[model samples]
Target: MPSPPSRVVAVVVTFNRLDQLKVTVARLLDAARTEGLQRVVVIDNASTDGTAAWLDAQTAAQAADGPLVVHRRATNGGGAAGFETGMRLSAEWFDPDWMLVMDDDARPAPGAITAFHASDRTGAMAWAAAVYFPAGGICDMNRPTLNPFWHRGMVTRTLLGMLRGRGRDGFHLTQHDYDARAYRAVDSGSFVGLFVSRAAIETVGYPDGSLFIYGDDVLYSLAMRQAGGQILFDPAIRFEHDFTTMTDADQRFKPLWKTYYHYRNLLLVYRLASGPWFALVLPLMVAKWTLKVRFHSGERGQYLALLGRAIWHGLIRRTQVDHAQVLEWAEPK
Candidate 1:
């Protein structure tokens, strides 16, 4: 008797970036047709732009050749909720052997998914792609790092590196060398091009939907690590990220609301990852936010207010907030 076919599903969370969505989905569908990809699950976060309609048309047009499972949310619960929904529904709908998660702005290079499957044969529970900017530079934020807290030698070396000011990623907890060989072990990775096994998801469960955006991937990857799962970063699995968001140290408050979510979710991530050690991080976080507010010229009062709210909710473990309320808080009075 022949063995059952291996199943792979790509789960994408998209907001209003319709052009990028179109390009990504097209590439994904092309890959699915040729590269043995089984299906794709797109979670649309109630985009005002015509993202939902475009996805609908794609679903209809490509139903036969390249299968797609698109779920349109009623409200914009942000990327965290979208991933939660997409992953859960992908499991229910396809029960895939592997699920590849990415954002709409992320486009997998040729053979990226293939590289993941090839690396998975080495007994990893999850694998992350080597994400790069569209201009071919490494995407700084998506670099996978080893959890020093999980390894004693790593902890000591990390501390020594920090003391020496060796590199920008002194702690060795947030960034990795992009040139690492295939299947380097890691603790976590971003959603940009992460592949998780069915067994791992079954063991650790879905990501917390309430996170509403930032740090969701970190929290989920840490949870997987805590569950005793192995995560590998496959440099051969390359993906390009069209990240146009602010990357500089401007610290201005134009996109003030996202700052709230970023810090709030970061605090929650630290609390969950460190447990009681979070007490050591809380004061540092407070000092950093305070400094940003003091130095930034844009809307200091509003930034302070948002920072306070973020700290309060993060401390209380309240990750979910209504989208409308967040908008109201973000809007200029």
Candidate 2:
């Protein structure tokens, strides 16, 4: 007899994006039966919109065996915290074989989850889907990357590519790789379409909630790799990220306070990526981020101050800074 279908649960972290969350949930529900989706655990990060009301209604309308599970936070804890809670809940409540994690604006393509179950995962502990924009192009930000520090050839190629201005394609998956049928080994990937096995979670634990946002997925996935867990990028399993793109000219943090988390968490990511060579990599990373302040013009002072604080806190591995404190610091003087 054929083996039973794998039990896959989806964890979606949402905050104020009710419309997108609805789409994501609807897609998951639509594929529930066909894809062996046991449950969809949605972590609402204190959304003020009608999200709570909608979720409540959905929960009330569900049967005893309903697949929808909503956990509404009393306070906004950012995506990282939301995922941490969602993943824990998923394992405790649904006991799925694998947990699929994504943002509110992302969802798997039709039959993608089925394809995931059908694929030969082999030695991989986690699998990343080929995330693409709604318009059918590769989502640059969601691409999986190889850790250059882990391999000498990767380090040489990445450094040479950076010197030649080849962008992240040196370290990240190439277009050719995306179009291929086989799974490729990746050191880290975004949360948009990442599927983590229960065994991997038991080994590496959940994502760091203290991160608030940014680099949490990379750090978590890198931790898995560091623990000898292989992560594979499966092009056959596709996901769509319905996110707005920013041009290079308009690529500054919107709230400004976000700069703190972005830079601080990035430091932790670099440290994890470089391992013992973090000290050697620190100056170069800091310099690259520091030079970006020139583009902020009017907010250069505030930007520089945030960068300084981020560097200090990151070096000390401090993630206890309050959100309100970051907001106060970002205020125009």
Candidate 3:
């Protein structure tokens, strides 16, 4: 007999934030109930705190009803690795057709998954990309333009720009074309929360985890659209997320050297995902970091110096997704 259809697979990747993880888990379970979901996967990125222990107890208690599976990575895989791991395992191992990706801190409003799936079944759309921050966050994830060789072509363009030693600065971002209406096509993906389809996964592959951070989600969504998948931004779902909490955006857990990954990864994405004549934001960002560092970081020109060095590195170094090795900022190993 043919195999049964794949159910909704909710995958959450967590780090040291046990409190946020617990709340996210609770909300996901609630989502399961509301949507009759039966598959759930929680990948703990090796939290040194009580998160792993609590999950162990939950499993032992058998209180995690409705198809719950938890796996603990040996190390923190950062955001991209965590997302890739959870998705790969869920679809490959568990055989779920639909995967709902949630960040450690993202909590969807009631019926968010249900609403997304409802739109998918409409037969007009293929996939649904969920919210990010700034607005309610649970707004929409849209698809980008189509060209057979676009993604790879842009990658070539980036290499050429670097080889020619030209100045281009600005991360890749497409202007919003559609009116802010209920159903519209978009060119961005809110990685914080996204509802992806199995077909999309089969088409786009997984997010690249290298260069450390940023742009994996948007690239994946774009790839899906290129492969004939539709990404919906149903306004029904809502969530909350900020760049950081009481901590300043400029004041991160890591030193300047390692944080350079953001610069590299974003440049990589802009090069791979943007149209011809990609504009690099390195100049503006360098200036911004210079100010933020000169004033906010307390050391004159420390972070600004780091930013300048980062641009040099990004222009030359090549990186790709490495799911096995991850370093979480919250806890040192």
Candidate 4:
């Protein structure tokens, strides 16, 4: 008697990116059989750009017999909410052994899923793929990182990097690590190409959907680690992220509303990452973000105001701010 095949269900959270969603879905479906993918669930976040219709058509084409599963939301709930819904539904409906989560603009590279299924994934509760841009460069946003607060050397390097204005390069996986053939342990990683085991989900539960966007993945991954779940970064498993490149020199947030989520959720992430050192770490993090306001000269006043509010709300763990209010604040007065 042989062991059962590992069941994998992919969860993609999409909003208004119909073109990218189409490409991602097609790739997932094409490799489903070969990679032991049990199902592909697309959580449509009330996209108005014919995304709903397209998903309906795909479902019809499959006659509800294929591996495709569509969960259409009645409202635009951002990526965090979309992922929460997709993961819960996937576990309830398909009961897969693992749930692979990624954004609309991301998908596994050719043979990547096959490699994942073939790898010896023992002991790790979650695994992150080596995500790269379409041009083959590493996607900095998707890089896996160790928790600096958990390691003495990492904390020292992080402090030195911050003082030198180099950012936190100490905890992040190096280019050499990506090129290596061995897997590395990571404390946290982005949602793109992250595979979460059912056991981990059962222990830590779903991601914090209230986060609404930025930092949700980091928070969830850190929570997984805090719950004693090990996360591994396997370079052999690869993903392609078709997203716009934003350099560190350009620290301004477009649409402005995203700034609130970025800063607010960042506070929560820092608290989780630092634990007992949060009191000391919070001020340093705030100062770092404040220094970046110099780059937002076009909307410096509004940017600073938003940052203040974000900091206040984050301190109180408040997440009920309406999106409409955020949009109004972003509007030019």
Candidate 5:
């Protein structure tokens, strides 16, 4: 006798990227026929783009047992909140054994879901997919990494790399890493194509919505690891991220003020991963930020002020995801 299929629900969080969402949904639905993907819940974050209308039309056109379901949020709560909303609704209605989360622009290729389900993740809490850019380059941002602070060899190699001016590049996955045929253990992963078991959610709870964006996935993955849950990166299951533009060296004051959330949430992720060792790591992080601002940014004084504010708030561990506060800092004075 054969084993029964696992019940899986895909939870997609969309903001304003309707075009990408359409492509993602179509591919996911087509893949469902063979992948045991029973349901899909799309959480729309108040998209101004005709996203709501498109969803309504799609839902109406499908059968009563159609896999697609839509949740239209009144306010844009960002990706973290959107994922939380989608997951909660999925559990309530679909009651799936597993849930896969991704952004609107992250599209799983054909057979991606089937490949993921076939992988032997016996006790993993979550599994990350190898994310490549649409043009077939590795999506650097979604590469799963080992926590250097947790492993001695990783820490030593990471220190050497930083001394060689590689910074934290040692922690990120390389092309060779992404092309591996076997499953590899990882400390953290992004939401893009992340599949989480119901047991994992029950153990660690949902991703913190207060993060708004940036590093929420890292924090959640760390929490799962802390709870004795394993996270694996299975390269066989791959997704494409629609990131055509390159912005590697431009992570500073040019954005004027999104740096607040970036650095603040990063600190939160670092603190979560570091535990009692956060005090030891704090000075190094601060010094690095100071140097980056001094050498790279054009608006030195304003950038320093924003960095100081972010560090202070991160120290105090503020959890409020205030869009207004971020916008106030983002606007030019």
Candidate 6:
């Protein structure tokens, strides 16, 4: 009827990181000219560093070449919020058959967009993702390695613990450099080079804005899988990512109040994905966090203090406002 909204919508969320973000847009535009991407939406969080103005110029230059919508927010909303806003806008305006979520530091190898179309996102195949990480390198595009137990908020916790300081374990967005031979799917990955079909969006909807920060992609991917959407990591498609900005200890990692959302969302994801049985294990998670903070790192006391407050807030109330809110989200797969 209405042309079924281009089958592919590309959305990018950026903040003040103008220099880094420039790379992603250049790649997307290049892909559009060669591989033919139809629609793209970029949401710029209120950036004081002239990012908004620069984007304005970029959009004007590409307006005729591609249908790109650029919107600038009044203030910074964390990556989760920016992504939520971008996804919603992408679905409403461009409504591509497949939505590609790219981050400022991530990208695709040649034909990465084509690999998305080749995944066959029809009837049963609801979710189609690219392969991630080639070798010990940073994350690349993902493969179809769906985790039987897909949990968004927690995927990083596991991967981070394993990837922490592992010498030679370079970082990338898609994580494609890990294993380039086959395609697989795990729980989730950074938003830098994510590809989603319209069918999956119709069923999964936008990522939970309530998350406010981290864990949105993990949660979104889990929803797609539970809805019978297949998460594939096509080896042929390579999305590039430069994910070595900060560390977990960074207060601005998500936001100052990220200590709250990270814990709260962790509980939320575990509850939804794991079920009552898993939810009951929240206490153990808390305990482990406490121990890790104390014994694992010197910030034990501070970690416990902050984590305790977060646990109380998440467990006590249905919703809470975190004073800290800024745009930022990414991780190694």
- Scored by lDDT, the top model is 4
Indicate the worst ten consecutive residues by lDDT in candidate 3.
166-175
Worst lDDT 10-window in candidate 1: 167-176
Q: Best-fitting candidate, measured by TM-score?
A: 4
- Model 2's number of clashes is 0
State, as a TM-score between 0 and 1, how close model 4 is to the true structure: 0.97
lDDT of each: 0.80, 0.89, 0.59, 0.89, 0.83, 0.61
Arrange candidates, best TM-score first: 4, 2, 5, 1, 6, 3
TM-score (C-alpha, index-matched) for candidate 3? 0.72
Going through the candidates in the order shown, the clash numbers are 0, 0, 7, 0, 0, 64
TM-score of each: 0.90, 0.96, 0.72, 0.97, 0.93, 0.75
Q: How accurate is candidate 5 locally (lDDT)?
A: 0.83
TM-score-best of 3 and 6: 6
Please give, for residues 9-121, the per-residue lDDT of candidate 6 as tens digits: 77888887898778777777777877768766788888788888888888878647566678887767667778888888877876567778877666676788766555444
Per-residue lDDT of 19 in model 3: 83
Candidate 2: C-alpha RMSD after superposition: 1.5
Q: Could you tell me how far off, in angstroms, the CA of residue 70 lies in candidate 6 after the best superposition?
A: 0.5
Question: How far in Å is the alpha carbon of 298 misplaced in model 2?
Answer: 2.7
Model with the higher lDDT, candidate 2 or 6: 2
TM-score of 2: 0.96
**lDDT tens digits, residues 1-333, model 4?**
857767899999999999999999999998886777889999999999999999999889985479999989888888999999999999999888899999999999989889988866758999999999999999988999999989877888988887887656878898998999998999998999999999988899999888788898999999889889999999999999997634566877776788888999999988889999999999988998898789887788788888998999999999877788888877666
Model 2, residue 132: C-alpha shift (Å): 0.6
Q: Which candidate model has the greater TM-score, 4 or 6? A: 4
lDDT of 2 by residue, 169-275 (tens): 77899899999988899999899999999878889999999889899999999999989999999999999999763445666888788889999999998888988
